[model samples]
Target: MPEQTTAAQTARADIPADGAGKPDAVVVRDALGVGIAVGLSGFAFGVTSAGSGLTVWQTCALSLLVFTGASQFALVGALAAGGNPLTAAAGAFFLGVRNAFYGLRLSQLLALPRVLRPFAAHWVIDETTAVSLAQPGRRAARIGFAVTGLSLYLLWNLTTLVGALGAEAIGDTDAWGLDAAGPAVFLALLAPMLKTGVDRAVAGLAVLLGLGLLPFLPAGVPVLLAALAAPAVLYVAGRRRGAGRGGTR
Candidate 1:
């Protein structure tokens, strides 16, 4: 009991003393800003999806329920191309499965309550992970991640409704550049989050693979291929590099 008490005291001491217990306004603002920016990508996705023949309900459902902009756009694009809904769903499912890995990492790091675990897992998306990891301080990461994720989720759903309804009367969505929104939004959202060589390598390889397979593969297949290939390549590369540096277990 004494040892446990001492350890608890030591753990508390590890928290920074200066303004450590207070909310970090700067980090919170930055986190919220990142979420808002990424949520714009969601709006862009809605616009593009609307242009691609998805109904307003479908766009809103994909944005609100699915909530992964990339997968939503991919699924919509596949459907627009007359691909099977099952095929589209499979592609979207695989791409979004990476979020489960994010949830695993976050569950260990956050140590959230069992009741809240489901909510946290749902919010563990790409932008949330990026914002959380980019936070400068330890506590800031946790608060920022949760706040940003919740904020983005709500705002994204609301704004997608706005975009979906407004897009119909805008006359040919492609003519208004709506069709280009998805790629542009993706680029903008990803550029700020990439902070490492491995991230860049994975992105570059995915892009290359996507381009290579797009012309030959069926709808949704190109991205699916790249998604599968990317992790394997990155894992092999990381292992090789670790071995070269004598850091492997």
Candidate 2:
């Protein structure tokens, strides 16, 4: 017990006092900013879906319930192309499966209150996960998660309504340059988080794989393909390290 206590004390000492390792404010700021920026892109979705034959109510429903940008876009786009609804739903389902992986990482990290976690699960998309994980501590992570999720949900729905109502006059949301804002903001936040060479490599590989597969594969398949690159790289790296150590032995 004494030895365990001493080890615990040493670990605590290693952590920098007052967040010398990570700043809390910066994480919160990034989360809020990213959420708003991404939420704004819902305007584009609203217009796009309306143009694609979705009613204003239907578009708003998707923004409210589906909540995931990529999957919602995939579903609408597929249906617009006259694809079967079940097939479209399946594609969207595959796209959303990535969030479950995010939830796995988060559940272990945040350890949120039971009352809050189920509600929080609805917000476990790309932006929230990125912002929360960027935080250095549990408190910051929870704040980041809640702020991003709430901000995105509210703003996305509002913008969706605006775009749906003004779909004809608004013309192309892409032409106004709103289309790229969310992804650009997300990438900017994510870039700083890729501190290690291995992390950068994994990100680069995922990007390459995802974009490369996008034109040929279905909408969600590219995301899944990109997801594979990180684990595959890690496995290969581990094997190489083992082989090098075995050779040295």
Candidate 3:
């Protein structure tokens, strides 16, 4: 009896803490689900981009290269509104900056070969980051990341081409309410991440700033100004914490 108990303990000890015990098939399924759902939104982008006066190739190129949905939407949305290209690009650049931070965290989690890092960096967008981080173990994380990235990349580009080509047949894309697809998908992904009070506060403030400034400011400028919401919320939170500590002391 004691021998059996000891062996069981040893087996449990050998298991990975991060839930590496999860089957590869399960991880792949979850990753694919996220990838396919988000990738379909690329149709909206392609249609919107083409309707905004971009050529079919240009719409496809943005999906292929820029890849990040929120940033791409912001750029095209601004341009469609007659904003300056430079300002639109700047807003999109600021939005894409978050992916760099995602890559930093993913670098530690993934630990891919040096040769693969550059290629993998392109896939370190929101959906891939979310799926990878949700996995229980390093191996699972890699699987999730790779599957999500590949599926989303392929589908997004493919759908973008179809949407751009069909844009004329679809008539006014905005009338179909397709323009909201990218942001709706993005918000769905983001809503889960605002798990804390601080996170929620920051998001709320960002929404307020973006909406409040939208009428007065140029198209992309509101987005740029809304980026200040994080620092503003953090500063206030920090001061409150300091004050609470002083009172406690």
Candidate 4:
């Protein structure tokens, strides 16, 4: 009886608390949705990179190796503006550093096998992290992370190749507004998650800081500065709560 009970408990633990149909299937569907939507934006990166004087191979290599949209765009955009290669690389490096923080959180959530950790670390980008953390259980999180990563990686690389090859025919990617696609999808995903006052405060302040500093700072530096919004908002909120408790006494 104890054996049967343990087996039943283990099986139930794998299911999502929301009971949203087959949890694995639901996770895959959602992950694929995010993956396909954001992955297509790789076309813009390819076109922009090629237009910025990169060869087709160079553009494709960036997409394949870096796999981070914001960093790739920042590097190419800075180069297009006549920035030094070293400086451009530095800015891109700063933009991609956020992925390391994402990996720290996802390592606990996914808890993948040691053999898979290195490979999984490569896919720890904004979209995959968002999809994995949205899931209710570890099983669902793993499925979401794997599906989102695989689909986005494949589609992004494929579209990047096509875009790089057809850069001349495309003329200017900005005119087509393809550059906005990734951010649009990201905001759509993030909008639903801002369910609390602190979440909204951090997001609002981040936007303000990012946009406000855009004209004054270098490309990726504004984003790095905006990251301060989280800690600033949290500190203020913590002080406010403490003061309220003291007032109640």
- Please name the candidate that would achieve the greatest TM-score relative to the true structure: 3
Worst 10 residues of 3 by lDDT: 11-20
- Best candidate (score: lDDT): 3
**Tens-digit lDDT string for candidate 1 (22-72):** 468876887789788777666666776777788889888787678887778
Best-to-worst order by lDDT is 3, 4, 2, 1
Candidate 2 accuracy as lDDT: 0.78
lDDT of all predictions, in order shown? 0.75, 0.78, 0.91, 0.84
Kindly report which residue stretches of model 2 are placed more than 4 angstroms away from their true locations once superposed. Answer: 1-31, 77-88, 134-136, 172-186, 213-227
Which order, best to worst by TM-score?
3, 4, 1, 2
> Given candidate 1, what's the lDDT at residue 40?
68
Worst 10 residues of 1 by lDDT: 13-22
**Model 3 lDDT per residue over 1-249, tens place:** 435566545644533446456999999999999999999988999999999999999999998889999999999999999999999999999989999999988877777899999999999999999998888877888999999999999999999999999999999888998889998998998999999999999999999999999999898999999999999999999999999999998
TM-scores for all predictions: 0.78, 0.71, 0.92, 0.81
Worst 10 residues of 2 by lDDT: 11-20
Candidate 3: where is the Cα deviation over 4 Å?
Answer: 1-19
Task: Give the runs in model 1 whose Cα sits over 4 Å from its true position.
Answer: 1-23, 136-138, 189-199, 231-249
How far in Å is the alpha carbon of 72 misplaced in model 4? 2.1
